[model samples]
Target: MASPGAAAAPRRGHSPLLLAAALLLALAPSPTTAAGRGVARECTYTLRVKTSCASPAARTSDAVAVAFGDAYRNEAHAARLPTTSGSRALERCGTDTFRLSGP
Candidate 1:
């Protein structure tokens, strides 16, 4: 028998511990990228702002903006900035109140 300090008895080809570890690593999967909270970050958290417009603002865009071959359309949306127009982006100061947008 080899002394306790000597090299461990050689196995046939592979060891059970190594096989088990390999199986565990293969089964226990991790995220490809650094996984964030299960919920998506861009999950439509409506941005809010307080402002006044001269009149009801209308949607208008100089150029056509399309994503994934889908053309965005504006219907009966009031508070939200249109697919073409934006509220927080267009907001500017005029006289007294902080203007969120213009009409």
Candidate 2:
């Protein structure tokens, strides 16, 4: 029995639920642990990645990342990976690290 214009309008009932979810997510604690702040012990790991192109001297300005996962799908990602040379020297990329929890 609704009019054409009323049927065409979007529903408003979900807005409050969405807003509450956003607020909860904003107030939730981040999953990352600082170097010495948490009770759980943490470790630092180093990974070396190599890429091959048609030209041996060619390099890319693209950002490189590293990720590893376990059988249960738990994953760790390193978004600030720096380029390295054959002699294990790091390129002049800035050092930054990011951490989050998800699949």
Candidate 3:
């Protein structure tokens, strides 16, 4: 039986495992292509993306980014800038601003 004042904690070895995981993650490369040019970069710069329009077909399909970075594979949508015209054509798709300092 345990003592009344005694408390339990995780094993000390757990830290090493976590450190290893963090190291691996820091060294891992973001998913990209053979070109590696778009293999993602340290998200220190502000990517002000703008497009003329996005057809209805573009709604569900992958976005065609002309910027210099890896495609937003699974990043969350921050906001959508719809056109005042209220047509299929949109002024901007969406905006994602963040600091992604990683490979």
- Sorting all predicted structures by lDDT, with the top scorer first, yields 2, 3, 1
The model with the greatest TM-score is 2
Worst 10 residues of 1 by lDDT: 18-27
For each candidate, what TM-score against the reference? 0.15, 0.33, 0.21
User: Candidate 2's residue-wise lDDT over 29-61, tens digit each?
Assistant: 335645345444233443433232222233444
lDDT of 3 by residue, 6-25 (tens): 88654553212111001112
lDDT of each: 0.26, 0.38, 0.32
* Model 1 agreement with the true structure over 1-101: per-residue lDDT tens digits: 88888987545543222110011111111334233445312111222322234323322222221121113231112353343334333332211111121
Error of 1 at 59 (Å): 14
1 versus 3: better TM-score goes to:
3
**Residue-pair clashes, model 1:** 0
What clash pairs does model 3 have?
Answer: 43-100
How big is the positional error of residue 47 in model 2, measured in Å on the Cα after superposition?
0.9
